[model samples]
Target: LLEDVKTVNIGNEMAVTLSAGIGMDGLSYAQNFEFARNAIDLALGRGGDQAVVKTSASITYYGGKSQQMEKNTRVKARVKAHALEEIITGKDDVIVMGHRIGDVDSFGACVGIYRITKALEHPCHIVLNDVTTSTKPLVELFQDNDHYEKDLILSSQEALDKVSDNTVVVVVDVNKPSITECPELLHKAKTVVVFDHHRSGTEVIENATLSYVEPYASSTCEMVSEILQYIGEHVKIHPEEANAMYAGIMIDTNNFMQKTGVRTFEAAAFLRRNGADMTVIRKLFRENANEYKAKADAVSQAEIYRGAYAISVCSGEGLPSPTILGAQAANELLNIRGVKASFICTEYQNQIFVSARSIDEVNVQVIMEKLGGGGPLNIAGCQMEDVTGTEAIAIIKKTLDTMIEEGDL
Candidate 1:
């Protein structure tokens, strides 16, 4: 359980509840988790049972977690947002690129690129490597329809054959360049536009012409929805495209429950207004019996801790789609009562991928970041180098303990 309080921050070490209670300042649940971590270090060591909250009205607090005497020094750092915008008034040919295996969200973002390019009256091509099938129906729709033509959506070899430095690359849903489904296009393109909702890790395209990344948004679909809207009212979205984007939004937001925000609802409302059928979206996400069995087994293997749960670990068995199903499993486990934090660890292409989720009591992004992962406060994801599940689990536990001990749990 968690509580909230809105009060002035008075200077100095004052007693405050440290474990998990509303601080004198009204911090949101996510903020509370973050504050708990900060308070633990300050109040716990400074003769525990006192909190030192530093806010606008000056620092003050009351009762912190039981601990004792030490000096609480200030940590000052200036973090700035990188340059996010620039308009290239000229139009040119473009290519679409994404991660190793395209998922619904990334594919949906490609749809955004299509819309933007069409509005600009620029020629565009979407590169499809060996693994684009993971995105499913969208591929078939684009293939069967004559509207796609030979202009857009090419195979890996075809892309390499046609791509040139003049090509404007639009990377969707993913930021890491090292693991891109196609690296040739990224190397060949002179101008690039990246749109994604994932937390930034080490690998990102540094020279992108226009990059829009908002990890706080529910999905890349939501991000793309905004970009498409900005493009204007003329671009028509076919039924399949509309439904695919809707499906992407639905999948990323867990049917609009986990990471729903004002912008997310607005994006959904736009898709609904655009004639996207909810029934089609519902059908698109339906899985077979084997998938259901896997999800159920994954949940059964979950372990619970103090308001936190290591709900599922990725086993390579997800086969055709380890990340997608594994993400679903982790999101499902979050629905369990008392599970304040949810994690999904899966082995994807020999790399350990971890997705973390949190409610008010935990900051999943911070935890992921501490372990070379990154994301927003509520939902964040990361990939571990090449570690076994057992080693990864130990690292996770130690990180959780450190977070809890420092009051950030």
Candidate 2:
């Protein structure tokens, strides 16, 4: 086998071929190299934490080095202040919003903005969509407070009626285009701002006027913590707001073991000082019998890919089973001693959804980005509109093989 091998020539350089029958189809070496350079996506479609290299003829594997680079507190602090300063020069009339499927993090970020905007006296409307918020108890927190505004939940037409050039829209928790969580508010806006901790995959809604996209932060609540510091004099961290943000922080960090950071702890501590109750947070995350069973089944079927990585699939008729089930499975996979990365893919509403997580050493964000999705290095996701979970798995493996071939291992 060694004697049969030959050093493959591309342009000016030569790379040894792995005998997968890779060759150009009657094309010049230069043209093929350019073609390879252009069409080959160095990342994505793999389970992540790997790379892909495609020449004219074949693709092959390299595996398992997934953590993203660690962040420095000083650098993050400076960048945060710079972003805050850019918006300080001109405060405009705006509506605060979040994804339609509201979670504790989304609601927490919205409330953080509401408090600041209320102090700024901006005419803010938080336009919620449909009955997406029907399952949340946090709604009661806002509704009970007469000071917090709550009249804007409406139809897509109603939301569209409210947008204008001066109408600045701020989206929290997620930056993806499909607002299945809040589609109406996104549709009518010309200017938008996004503050999210999740990875940004391929699907998008143009660009926001101001976007603070950081996958390193633990949660949207952490990003909101930065914003609250910016508006230091105007607002206080109320108990309810603290509880909401704390719940998000704890959930994303998996109780501070998987992806927690110094800032994460600091934010949680501040919220605790404001009187956040852990018992109430426990109540919020409690799953019904159906949800618990769905999660357990997904975890049981999980398989280890490389020695360090694990992956599983959860197929369902709707979004909740996949979304909640995927995260729960990922958390469960982490329990295995050698496993550093966990990926769960499931079918939902005509789309294939994926959720990936890693220990502090792996960057799931970089891997997810290749699949047109993004988040912090430790946790991320992607959505495939016209594919099944099985097809998605093949794409991931081939991409991994190619990444190994290219030495992005």
Candidate 3:
């Protein structure tokens, strides 16, 4: 039904798509209607052009092959910024968090929110645990500094202890509760806000006071940069903060080469006016000798599966952050001709992390979703437990075969 819907055209120049929701086996009519509404929201949240079926037992998806359309207006950002300002002003305190094992985009977005809360003269703390190598340099700028509070960054337990009835928790870069830096804070706070660029999935942070999840935005940093412009006319961005946010936009967009649009450049220009320096960001992200070698090895040893998918394993021995290298390797594999998508697997913290990337031909997000993970169509990831790299590769291959047979690939 969805495939046929996708084939419909408008005036032979543009295609018309449909998003559907089906609910079954409900105990009451109202419950069934609620389920249907939720399913349709999920389908639209996942970038439309899909169908979601919800039952009391499970949720299923179908036909999400289309690319998400980017909005060309800044009206939504302006409205969200004003709403966020009101929420912060009403709260006694604010706590900001990103996904665990923080990256530039995640940490940068946190900093952006911190600025907002501080400008309102509301006490704010960023919850971060286990800072990886990629994020340490940026984090150090805020630690033990007179410009910011001494407890600017707190651990999960510390955040939990500090959260109060009047606190508003702002989750950035990631929307999934399970992967948040401190999921407990969500339950403790009276109000919660979410800002992310990833497509919505089955799992999400429920009952958010405000949500700004634009899959079309290049990165969460881009979205935050736009919000910063409208927060207040006097909200000044420090060079360090500008640099942090700029690094996020740079890294997530792969130096403005992927997932970038006109608004992305506009956001970067805004940061530049606030004293963002490209040279400083480049110096911060410079790779060490071992890190470079590990990434190259992963790329050199890559295996092209089915002549379209590039698969490789990044060895983590003696590496501070192997998953970062894995994601870099995945991006590098896209340069190979005839490769529709790339998947780089790395063993870290007793689990296998798979970072998937694609240019256009394949929807890597759908594949990752089937493996219990999700992101944008171009960049996605999943994690598996108790599986060897070779075993994970075989499993991925089987999934690809099944998806291909079902005409989903």
Measured by TM-score, the strongest candidate is 3
The per-residue C-alpha lDDT of model 1 at residue 374 equals: 61
- In candidate 1, how many Å is residue 374 off? 2.2
Task: Please give, for residues 280-388, the per-residue lDDT of candidate 1 as tens digits.
Answer: 6676567777777876777788888654566567575746777766777777777898788888787877778887876656667667767876655566677888797
lDDT of 3 by residue, 316-355 (tens): 8889889999999999999999999999999999999999
lDDT of each: 0.65, 0.64, 0.92
Error of 1 at 383 (Å): 2.6
lDDT of 1 at 372: 74
Could you say which candidate leads in lDDT?
A: 3
Distance (Å) between predicted and true CA of 160, model 2?
A: 2.1
State in Å the error of residue 322, model 3. 0.6
Candidate ordering by TM-score (highest first): 3, 1, 2
Which window of ten consecutive residues has the lowest lDDT sum in model 3?
Answer: 6-15
Error of 1 at 263 (Å): 2.9
Which stretches in model 1 have alpha-carbon errors above 4 Å?
Answer: 1-89, 130-134
- Which model is ahead, 1 or 3, in terms of lDDT? 3
Kindly list the per-residue Cα lDDT of model 2 for residues 325-359, writing each as its tens digit: 67768878888889877888888777878888877
TM-score of 3: 0.98
